[model samples]
Target: MSESPSTRHPRELATAADPAWVDAFVVELRLLGVPGDEIGEHLVVLDTHLRESGEAVDEAFGDPREYARSLAPGGGPAAAVDRSTVAMAVLALVGVVLVPAALGAVLDGTRVTVTLGGVLAAVLLGGALAGLVLPGAPLLALLVRRRWVSFLLAPALVALGAGLVLLLPQVLVRVPAPLVLGAGAAAVLAGSVLLARAPADLVTAPGERASGGGGRLLGLLVLPVFALVACVPVLLVRLLG
Candidate 1:
């Protein structure tokens, strides 16, 4: 008699699970903001079904990404970023802006001040960066569509951005070093607090994560980590120079 999926050794069940398909499904679910633990459970259940019926993933689920959209809490990924998370994102955005401002302040030998043009440049660039997000969706879609294209897409985008930076000149502005750093530190701290208070979006199981859901500490660490990354080089420059 064929063993039921539940009674089968876990190793057998795991072997039956299609890791590639599972990864694609998980990515779609994550983009839809499905909880981590719930995603893990769904993976297990899908694996069980696959074992029991001996069906292909494509046959069992028309498209994993579409299935994820259906599973979204409010029936879509549209409003997945709750208001509080958006607030956290804003603060994080501020942190991103300050990095370039601070770096421009240091590089131009205007450690105490930068021009208004610099700050304005950050703001304008932020909006442009937002536009690039649409391209990211296509990149994610390529996960299932054409994976090799994805492999090339990532580094190409990075290279393009780097090349653009070299072509553009830094705009100087009043880069009040202490004030900028202080506000940056404040923004990072505030963002961290918001992230902590932000609902635990990723309902990960004991040892499972839903895509990029790195849980609370990881969320909290993000701002400060980036802040340090921004500030450390300036500190190094000051110390040696």
Candidate 2:
């Protein structure tokens, strides 16, 4: 006699316990342009089925993205982009780029010297390059489980920004404070604008979400905390030297 369907898929018993998989499924469905109410209904049904049957997601309905696509035909790779995703990306990028710059400026004050100006230019260039290469480094880092990369990115931005602030006083003739601050703010704003206009598909992935609340809070705090710790050494050097 053939084994029963549920008995045949004993491995699927674990599916009901894993909420991440369901979250990912809902995300993909949202990306495919499924209405919010419809998505919620689908999730409720799936959750009910999983609870009752104790089947692995793949065993019951196949891969989440594929399953969603099957249900919503034509909601494939070419689906219309969600504006909220783009807006979130823009806000995140702006925050990552501008926050550190603003902090650094506050620390450095208005005194500008030639050496400081040169350092500022180099740091700005480096930031520009990072923006070009990483584009949405902070947000991307948050989505994926690349802990080391994520940890490093925000600190690096802060360090560069702080370094620029430290150097700002060395120049004999300082650029106006307003210009420096304005430029940093404007650059980040422009970056946000560009990101907002990028193809939706490129900006957000199906099933992509920010990490948990604790992780996000930590991600935001890391830069400032690092900046504070880093300043200790700089302060000591200034005092001792």
Candidate that would win on TM-score: 1
C-alpha TM-score for every candidate = 0.63, 0.41
Query: lDDT tens digits, residues 49-152, model 2?
Result: 97898887678887776887776746554344345444444444444444444445446574323366556755564554444334234334243434477578
Show model 1 residue runs off by greater than 4 Å.
1-15, 37-41, 70-77, 103-121, 128-175, 203-217, 232-241
In terms of lDDT, model 1 sits at 0.61
What RMSD value applies to candidate 1? 6.8
Q: Per-residue alpha-carbon lDDT of model 1 for 116-194, expressed as tens digits?
A: 4434445555554443234234334555457687578667655655555555546454446667767776788889988
Residues forming the 10-long window of minimal summed lDDT in candidate 2 = 2-11
Looking at model 1, which ten-residue stretch has the lowest summed lDDT? Answer: 1-10
